[model samples]
Target: MSGPFVYVPPVNPVNYPPSPVHYHNSPYLASFYTDPNSPFIPPLSLSGNASPYQSPNTLNSPLPTVLTPNAVPFPASSSGSAFAPENPWNRERRVSWNGSVAAPTVPNSSWLQPPMYHYRRRSDAAAFPFQQPVDWTSLSPYAPYRTELVQQSFIHPLLNAEDRRNDLILDMSCPSFAPMRNIGNNQTAPITPEELNQLAFYPQAYGAHIYCELIPDLPIDIRYRPLPGYSPIAPPLKVGDILAAIWNDMQLGISQEMWASLDENRELMISRAYTKRCKIWASRGFPSMRNAGVKKVDCLLGKVFFRGLVPTGDEANTLRMIVA
Candidate 1:
């Protein structure tokens, strides 16, 4: 059942179009009344309907020359459709003005959705795209041995002589006068707070001389010279042997040493010349002597037990361990 066509005046005449002008048309457009009591309605026919001005049996009266427009082609039949379109984004069932029937809820069930993204360790990057290799910058070959480092002293030690002498000679002629021939822990005094805090020292070897070395933790390319009497290619002790022997017990046994007898006397003397060139802990321990500076190693010529050098005159108490 449709309403009859009528010449209902546009409440706003300007909006209807001036006089007899034609207008654009779409299948989606609808006609409506502004006043509730108005009796006229536009013809229901599209451009298919004949114009009232041009023919008999046409739309009646005042709006006789209605602004009928030419229709555009429709995509589909307009049956069972509304003037307004269904929302393209309307994903769920919804109610309409006419009926209870609504669009079935879009099947949001798992069967209709895309499959779950499965992940596995694959050679392809897509599997673990964000994954990365181990951060080797944070790694090291000597990582395990790094625990040996201790807290360093911030304060400086009091001025002290770098080289000290001890009368380490034993006199067989005056037997009873000098009963003590062998040096022991009792000969050394207890450590003072200053020595422990300001100096880096091993308490066991504080007064006694034990072989010490400060090998650089980094790999170095060094062209070195062997001892005066030893051959350059086949020295008495090699880099590996020295490192192993020094670390074995710190103090190597005198009677147990199997060494080639060569310049024995000159080798025993850890003279001032050797001390100045060696890497004494006090020298290398300083920040100024590290990294960019040239570094030397403290080498032991003979075993820690072997003796030829000793303090002269009154320098007995401060018999500093001379490193050759």
Candidate 2:
């Protein structure tokens, strides 16, 4: 279904009246020269130009001129005697429509006063209608309110649980936050090195790569490379923990940088080991181990060790030499 449509009318230009004329009271100011009560005496040249005893009726004012047709519509003002030079004969002529209207009249009210069409606003000065006080106790605290409060007294317990859940599941889907297996209060026998060495043999035919070159003195050959598993011990160990263990055992002196390089190659092996471990545990109806995230596993052999080493694909010979 379609939504409702609205039609709006266009507006027209409004008409306004011409502005009232404004008279500058300068004309009467010049008359002060003849009055003795004036604080400023007129200059001699100005006094000489001024006429002595001219009757008000003898004054001849020029016809009011239009300064601006639409905007001002009024002539500038001058002293009553200023017209003397223009009308030297002093004949009082009716320039305005009515002789009595020669001077402009001031309006009783301002032009900006509200128009007659405008309704005057009657303010309600009295206080707002009294409202009865609410009995808040009668209303449940859990009642829904659209307004949010800052530092409100009541906190919803669900909010904390939601925050914890958000921290766990980034995409809000599966049980990503499950704890690691054998990590809780339960205790189990630790894996031994003998078992690890036994498990290191690859039953699936790729195992030959793992044995150390039994003939390191033999010039390195092609096709029989070391099938280096992620680590000497199975079950992914933290690269640091493994290096520390090696240092503690005092078997070989390998630097952290060498270990770092080994881990890079070790990642694929580590992933495979974890996959195998997970399958075994699952088949036994045991809980799966949680991923501790991919860790860097470095090699003990320095780059110098493999300087001229090449692959030699003689499995029977290599296995005999390696097993020896």
Candidate 3:
């Protein structure tokens, strides 16, 4: 409970009229004042023993405002529920303090928190939402690496390297002089290291050609198998045909000679007239010769293939096959 007042008139009443009156009338005020340490005392009664402050019907009624014994009682004319409010500052401060105490209890007042700061969490451990896991089939360090085996009967190095060393040529070829062979693996003198490497990379047609050369007595019937499920031989044998077949088996590497030979057959050749207008086009690198460039280069190479200096047919087949 708040301390009780003693009656005392303000010296400067015009300026400090709201000061507590306890100092002006302590003796009378003390008689009614609630003691700081004592249990509450009921208000004085109209009857000798009946308490006036204990009426159940008037429990919620406004309590009387106390005044000092020496001071004149002011008429009850104020509109405020709180007693002794003399200035707007005290009234406003009480209203503000009450509002602050109630703020957390009101659901509608949740706007007191900033919207952007609400529900925010640190993203230090967040992962990229769209990131895919690494592929272990492509990244496994101990995965086996396979070495390719060249087929014995194919003509081109590129073709030979694609198929394992199984060929009808070696199976049917004569064991005598001019026997069909498996290129570098033929029973002959040691092939040069360079040729051995080439043999390793040769396609079917070149492999067959190498086989034929290694064993001169090898029969032509042994060189290539008939197409699957039929007895028909692979196709009409031409040096360019063998070269083209082998060329098909390559990844992207094509020999200049084979490319030129390919031009004679494909008819997509480079012409002097076209190159003269574009020297840069003429001097471009071999791999770059593709599409329109391939056509142009083929035209130029075809002319050289048909020149009198180059022989045609099986007689010149060896030279044509090798150079290409």
Number of the top-ranking candidate, with TM-score as the measure: 3
The whole-model C-alpha lDDT of candidate 3 against the native structure comes to: 0.29
Candidate 3 lDDT, 1-324, residue by residue in tens: 978976543332111111111112111112222221021122323673366454422454545455432232234526543334354343343443534454433223333322332333448536666656555455433344455774322233222322344221210101111112233332222212232223221222222332222213321221334333544444333333332232222112234665555444343333442343244433433223233333222323322111111112254223222111
Cα deviation of 186, candidate 1, in Å: 17
Separately for all candidates shown, the number of backbone clashes (residues 3 or more apart, or on different chains) is 2, 17, 49
Candidate 3 clashes: the total is: 49
- For 17-42, candidate 2 gives per-residue lDDT tens digits of 11111212121112111211011111
Model 1's TM-score against the true structure? 0.14
Off by over 4 Å in 1: 1-189, 193-251, 255-258, 261-324
RMSD of each: 46.5, 43.8, 49.9
Q: What is the Å distance of residue 44 in model 3 from its true position?
A: 99
Error in Å for residue 68 of model 1: 93
Please give, for residues 11-69, the per-residue lDDT of candidate 1 as tens digits.
33121111221111211111110121021122234454455545443343322223333
Cα-based TM-score, every candidate: 0.14, 0.13, 0.15
Ranking by lDDT: 3, 1, 2
Q: Model 2: runs farther than 4 Å from truth? A: 1-259, 263-266, 291-324
Worst 10 residues of 1 by lDDT: 28-37
